[model samples]
Target chain A: MPILEAKNLTYTYSIGSPFEKTAVDHIDLSIAEGEFVGVIGHTGSGKSTLMQMMNGLLQPTSGQILLDGCDIWDKKTDRRNIRFQVGLVFQYPEYQLFEETVYQDIAFGPKNMKLSEAEIDRRVRETAEAVGLTEEQLKKAPYALSGGQKRRAAIAGVMAMEPRVLILDEPTAGLDPKGRTKILTQLQAFHKRTGCTILLVSHSMEDVARYASKLLVLSQAKVVCYDTPTGVFAQSQSLESMGLALPQITRIFKQLAEKGISFEDEVYTVKYGAELLKTRLEGRNPEC
Target chain B: MLKDITLGQYFPMNSVVHRMDARYKIVITLIYLVMLFWGQQIWSLAAGLIFTATAVFCSKIPPKMIIKSIKPIVPILIFTGLINLLMLDGGDVYWKWWVIRITEEGVQTSVFMIVRICLLIAGTSLLTYTTSPIVLTDAIESLLSPMKKLKMPVHELAMMMTIALRFIPTLIEETSKIMAAQKARGADLESGSIVQRAQALVPILIPLFVSAFRRAEELALAMECRCYHGGEGRTRLRKLQSGLRDYIALAITLLMFAGVIVLNAVLH
Candidate 1:
């Protein structure tokens, strides 16, 4: 069974007003256990709204979300528990950090879960280490850290909860290239080690292509595609029409293929493209 | 859920009231409020009500929206009415209690106060519903331009007002976002005791303050980059011009207030 499922979820903003907007409309998808799902869309295509609904932060106007075969919106089902189960780290989550120390900030989620102080301390330190924060750094004020460290601390706050399904919205936004890579690589390591399901909402096609096992494309508040990264990138034309572009490497490979150069259509990452090119070069120049 | 707040929010629509100059609307609203409070007699109050109802109809704003604006102050309305009903000790008593008495004059005064307050809110809300905040600020600045001679910094004040009004929606959106982010971390804002709920606000308030400060800093930098020197000879794209409709609105407001004064003199 899917770890988390959204069935016909819809959210309308400013209903009954002139600004009424259907932010998320009839979105149906499921995140399997240990799957890293990438959510991509145009700026106003309801990616944030859908992510909020998945964790019960925003209630769906219609339809339901199911976690572990039970409706999360069921009256008897504690919604707060669902938040603990599905961790949502919003964009620029560092702004949400309020605790005096990074360690205390990271302990917030586990404390909310009513864990014992020792357990909370253990989780805080463990998640902080996983996110690459040193012990001295964790003891310092969160505001004293650099921007990237603050972001990692904020993400560690959610991770300390040990949520089964983690959802991060543009976790690397506004970060420098090195900071972005460091955060994403650490997240990749965390996912690999814990085997937790993750839904990463990102604008970078290349980043998603590299790490996300599955890609979900949204356009005009509806899901246009939900499939493996290779399968989704194969529909480059449709994705472009929806205001999304394929990964740069995939586009370059496509252009090469169109110029009478035979190559696989599913090359989405630079590493994979380089590997393909190296093999082709070795085949063409046997001496080299 | 915080989005339902429509107080001081402008609803854009094409209507005579909306097209009227903001200065005229503001003046007329002030005059209407004065009439509401000055009209003490039954006939004057009735005239005020009819005037407000007609203005509401002409504004073309939904009556439901006007009622929604009044909903937040329902408790105040009841409190005032109850105080007037029990405290006013004139005319024949209909019911008596330890410290509460319902007399004819008390009932009349309570009804009068409640109706006046309702009309006051309805009239003022119509002004906001018709005029956008930018236009309103422009009108205020233009109207207060004469105060510049007194070293009052009219332009600076108006600029500050406009900026503050503009950030209301932005701040509200930020607040909701911060609230959602906190809630996602299992910060229970809803089902807590009074103290716990207030304490829960710390998580939201700190982030809101941080982001607000960041936004202000960024805005200041952007403004400075664009050479935004505090309202010194800044020309507006849309100049406020008074038209025939503005005159008509002004005439109606003045005539209503004069008519209420006359009716009060004759009836009471």
Candidate 2:
């Protein structure tokens, strides 16, 4: 069964008014356990609106959100419990930090879950370790930390809840390349270590290509395509027509293929590209 | 539910009222209010109503929108009318029950008070509905430009109002986003005790306040980068012009007020 499922979800803003707009229109999505799904779209394509609906933060205009074979919006189901089970880290989450100490901020979710003191401490420490935060760093105020640290602390706050499903909206936005890679690597490691389902909403095709196994493309408030990253990237012409582009590596590889230099495997990451080049070079000059 | 708020809402249209000088509209509105209050006797009240109703028609604003604007203050209107009805004791009593007396004077005073308040609100709403906030503030600043010689800070006041009006919807949107973010973390904002709900707002308020400060700092930097130095040498793109329609509007307002005054004198 899927960890999270949205069936025919729709959201309309400013309904019954002259400025009314339909943001998300009848989107159907199903995310299975341990799957990292990447959502890509142009700005105002309703990606954030769909993310908010999955965890019950937004009630859909019509349709249902089912988690673990039960409707998340069921009257018998506790909406808050669904929230705890599905963690969401909004864009620029560092702006949401308000607690005096990093440790207290990270422990907020576990505390709200009514866990025991020792359990909360254990979860907080584990989350801090997962996000590469030092014990001393936890003692300081969140506002006093550097921007990257603040972001990690905010992500750790969601991780401490131990949710089975995690949704991140532009986790690497406004970050340096090193910082972006660090956060994405840490998220990938967390997914691998805990086997949790993850949904990442991003506009960067390269980031989505490297990190997500499945891909969903949105355009004009509708799902244009939903498939594996390779399948989605193969339709580069259609994506470009919609004012979008494929990952940088994918474009390079496609050019190489057009020039009659096909490789055995598709290379999406720098490491994979380097490996492919090394093998080709060894075949040309074995002594060197 | 916050979507229903139409305060300061600008409707874009190409009507005669929308094209008039906002400063003149403001002056005419003041004159209309003065005449409404100056009205006495049935003929004077009827004349005032006819003038207001005609402006309402020429403004091209939907009649229902004016009704919605008057909807919010209904409670206060009802309260004032009821108080007048219950308290006036000069005229002959029509009915008495349990120390509550209904008198002819009380009834007349209640109806007059209701009409006065209704006309007052309806007249102002027409101005707002027809004029955009930027135009309105610019008109106000222009009208008050003479006070700048008295060190009244008219430019700064108008600038502040413009900034506030621009940010109201942006901040409302930011607040809703913050509220959703907090709610996603198991923060129960709804279905809570009043105190609990107020407490739940802390999570939202902190982020909203932080973003507001961030926006202000960014705006300051942007203004400095653009060499902004207040309204010292600013020129308007659309200069306020007093055309034939403006003259006609003013004449009608004055003639209506004069006719009411004459009727009040003759009838009394």
Candidate 3:
């Protein structure tokens, strides 16, 4: 069974008001257990809005979201419980840091869960380590931390919840290349260790291509395509029409293909590209 | 769901009211308020209501927007009306119940009080709704310029007011963002006891205050970089000028006040 399924989800903002807008319109999607899903969309394409609905942060103006085959929006469903099960980290989450100390901020989720003090402490420490935050850093005030540290601290706060599925919206936004790599690598490691389903909403095709197995393309508040990363990248022209670009590796391969150099396989990652080049070179001049 | 707040919200329009000099508009609104309170009878309220309605119609602002602006004050208006109705005991008593009495004078006083409160809110909202906050601040600075002789920091006060008004919406948007972010991390704001609910606010308020201060510091630096120094020798991009339409508007307000006086005298 799918870990999460959203059937005909529709979310209209400012309903019954003059400012009424269909932010997320009739989106049908499902994420299987332990699947890394990449959601790509331009700004205002309702990717964020859709993520909010998945965890009951927002009620669908109309439709159903099922978690573990149970309707997440059932009248008796505890929305708060759903939040723990489906953790969501919004873009620029550092701005949401409130607790005086980074430790307290990371413990916020567990505290809300009403877990024992010892358990909260253990989770906080583990999560801190996962995000590469030191004990000294955890003791310091969140506001006193550097921007990248603050972002990591915020992510740790969510990770401390040990959610079944982690949904991050533009997790590496506004970070330096090093910061971005650290965050993405940490997330990748986290997924590998926990086997948790990850729903990453990102604008950068390269990042999504590197991390996610499947891609869901959103346009004008609807899901335009949901397929494997390679399958989605193959439709580069369609993605381009919506102001989206193919992953850098995919683009380079496409350029090579356009130059009449047909590789047997599509290259997505640097490793794949390197292997393909080595094979082609060996075929031409079998010296080594 | 948190985006419906309308406090200090300025609608963008290019009507006559939008184009009128903000300083002149402020002066005219003050004069109209004085006229509203000057009359001592029911006809004065009638006249005030009439003038207010006319201003609303001429401003080209939707009536629903004005109603929304006055919605917050509705509770106060009702409270005042109820207090006047229940407490006042004069003239002939029409009905008497257990420890309660309804008098003719009470009925009249309640209506008058409600009308006064409604008119006051409706008339003031006209000024705010039609005027952009920046223009309103400029007008306030100009109006308070006379007090500069007494060493009052009129420009500074105006500057503060403008910034406050400008940031009200921005802060509200920030607050909503923070709330949603915390909620994502399993911070349950709803479905809690009073104590739990209040405790839940910590996650929201702390971040909000942090961002607010950060914004304030950045704004200060930006202002300093732009050589902002207490409105000294500052030139305006738009100067206030009163034309024929303004004179006509002033005349109409005066005439309405005179009509109220005449009606009061005739009724007596």
Candidate 4:
């Protein structure tokens, strides 16, 4: 069964008022486990609203979300338990850090799960190591840490819960490029080590193209497409019309293909694009 | 759920009440509050009811929204009404139930008190619904300008109020975000004992306080960057000039107060 599935999901803000808005309208999705999925949309495309519904933070106005083929909104389900199973790191997760020490903050999720003290400690230390927080850093207050370190500490708080599926909404927002890459790489390593399903909501096409195995596109509160990164990149024309774009390297590759230099595969990442260009150049050198 | 509050929420409509100078609206509201409480007779209180109903109509705000503004204060209204109903000793008793006796005067006073409270709330809410906060701030500063000669920090106080009013929605949004984040981590905010629920609020309050301080610091730095130095020689984009509409509004408020006074004198 898919780890998370939304069946005709819908959310309307301020119903029956003049300012009523349908933030997420009739979205249906089935996401398999252990795959890093990227959700992309422009501002007000319902990305954040959908993420909140995934973990039972919000009850659907109509329809339902199924986690492990069980209706999450069912009366028999404990919504709090579903939260532990599917952790969500909101945008600006660092602002959610409030504990005096980084270690205590990282242990918050495990503590809430009613785990024993020793187990909570072990999970906190393990996730801290995974997120690249040192022992010295963990001993200090969260506010005392640098911006990147504080963010790492906050992410570790969710990681310590060992959730089967983790959803992060714009995790790398408001960070320098180096900080962004460090956080993403650590998240990648955590996924590899734990085999946890990750759904990353981001506006940056390049980051998602590089990290996500599957890409889900939302436009104007509706799903436009859900496909592999390469397949989605191939629909660049339609995506652009939706106020989204292909990654820079993929756009460059598309331009080259239009100029009669065809690539066998859709080029998305810079690494793969370099290899494709090198092979094409080497093959055409003798003819030139 | 917090966003449903219509109290102090401005409704943007191009009606005559909305176009009236905000200073005039403020004075009218103060007078409205005074008139709501000054009279003891039911007929005098009817004047306040008629005035509030008329103001609500002229503002073009929906009746449903006006009802929403009164929702939050219902508990207080009920408490006061009950105190008046059971506690007052009167000559004629209607019903008696073990220590709680409903007297004729009790019913009369309870109804009168409830109506007064409702009119008081509805009258002030109409002012907020019609006047935007920034304009309200400007009106307050202009009204308090006389205190500037006495070395009072009138400008600073008004600036503080403007900032506070501006940040209320932002802070509420931030609070809801923090609460949701904590809930996603299995923090059970609902269905706990009284103490446990209060404990759950710690996570929310700490983060809210931290973010509020950060925002304050950033605002201070930004204000400094723009060469902000107190309120001296500061001109406003929206000048509070009393126009023909304002004077007309003032006349209507004066007439309402006069009507209430005449009703009290004749009826009481």
Name the regions of candidate 1 deviating beyond 4 angstroms.
A12-21, A285-288, B35-47, B63-118, B252-268
TM-score of each: 0.88, 0.93, 0.90, 0.88
lDDT of 4 by residue, A1-288 (tens): 788999999999888988999999999999999999999999999999999999999888998899999999999999999999999999999999989999999988999999999999899989999989999999899999999888888988998999999999999999999999999999999899999999999999999999999999999899998999988987888999998988999889888989998878888889998998888788785856
Could you give candidate 1's per-residue lDDT for residues B1-268 as a string of tens digits? 7776555689999888898888888888888888888988887788878887888888889999999889989999999999999889888999998978899999999999999889888888888998998999899998898898898999888888888888888999999988988988889887769999999999999989988899999999999999999767798789888998888878877997999888878877
Q: iRMS for all predictions?
A: 0.6, 1.1, 0.9, 0.5
Q: What is the C-alpha lDDT of each candidate?
A: 0.90, 0.87, 0.88, 0.91
Number of the top-ranking candidate, with DockQ as the measure:
3
Predictions: Cα RMSD each: 3.3, 2.4, 3.2, 3.7
- The CAPRI class of candidate 4 is medium
Q: Better model by TM-score, 2 or 4? A: 2
Listed in order, the DockQ scores are 0.76, 0.62, 0.77, 0.75
Deviation from native of the Cα of residue A270 in model 1, angstroms: 1.2
Model 2, residue pairs in steric clash = none
Which residue pairs come into collision in candidate 1? none
Please provide TM-scores computed only on chain A for all of the candidate models, following their numbering.
0.97, 0.96, 0.96, 0.97
Q: Candidate 3: where is the Cα deviation over 4 Å?
A: A286-288, B9-15, B41-46, B62-114, B255-268
Worst 10 residues of 1 chain B by lDDT: B1-10
